[model samples]
Target: MFRRRASVVLLALLLAGPVIASPPAIDPAARNPPPTIALSHFDRFELQPVTLAPGLETHKGNVVARQYLDVDVGERVPRLIEPRNATPVQGEPRTLLIQPEVADIRFITGGKRVLFGGFAGSSWALVKLRLVDKATGEVVAEPQFLQHANSIAAGYSLGAADKLMLARLADMVASYLKTNFDAPVGSAVAAAAPPMD
Candidate 1:
């Protein structure tokens, strides 16, 4: 009887063993780079507002005829990848070129001056930028971002509007960068016994 009970106890212990073990956790955002590509975290930067040009006052009454703006999409990807055993990178000095198409303009803010009746014509411009993978000497991704039908407000221009635009656009570009640059994080471990949903 004693021997039989001991044997059953051992069997029960074996059957219950795996139920108590836990699976490993993984971060959803980590990506493992391909062998040829070295992945790195994104660098941070500050937004320095450009001082309104003196010519802007002269530009008003002329009307914002058109604007050509270029936002490169792929420039943001490297920041999403968290490279293993690598030091954080510093934000590079850079500029965002904004060429505007203006029409029906009455004023230009920032110069503390105004133009009442200058040349009134419509203008627009499109821009292209290249973002390179320095190590591979290749362009990883380049997406063109655009905003059409922009209404130029030369009179009492809201500085806040520009700030808001920058913040929103930067966020949009950043998300695109993260999606393209990083790989989906994988689970490093397997559950001893996966539970059925």
Candidate 2:
């Protein structure tokens, strides 16, 4: 009776060994490619329809304006995709969020022009931006405060001009990522494979 029981137990252990001894499963995030940036709008600032013109030459100095710039992913995504060599698998890439804060915009218009309306000068815009991982809530890129300046024309809307300059900045960022960010966005160190006994 004892010998029969031992044999049965031995058979059961042999059958269960394969199931019990498998290594732990890998995290789902590891298999995927880098996170793609999600479509995002400006949070702290608002884009108004009103256009900005060369107002009266202020006594203080350059005219200062405050507004948020909007990023249209539908329009800009193709531009971002252009520089990247790898075609990431669809539906597998994680999502990242782009946030921008407009600190201040300074317009430098001095003297007076004849044909173009006035002797308009360059406009310098200060902006703060960040990129964050949606799933992990990690800040992928360091907080950046950028000052982008462009020559102001006669009929250019403030919002439209701001959008164009910001879009160029975004393109530069995408190019940087294409060249520098080669590895997975935020992959953890892989665990060693379970040793075969």
Best by lDDT: 2
Q: Measured by TM-score, how close is model 1 to the native structure? A: 0.31
Best by TM-score: 2
lDDT of 2 by residue, 81-178 (tens): 43332444455455555454443444332222122222233444433344566567776553322333444442144334434444444443333333
TM-scores for candidates 1 onward, in order: 0.31, 0.37
Over 4 Å off, model 1: 1-129, 148-157, 183-197
**N/CA/C clash count, model 1:** 23
Candidate 2 displacement at residue 27 in angstroms: 42
- The window of 10 residues in a row where model 2 has the poorest summed lDDT is 41-50
- Assess each prediction's global lDDT (C-alpha) against the native: 0.28, 0.36
Looking at model 2, the pairs that clash are 113-119
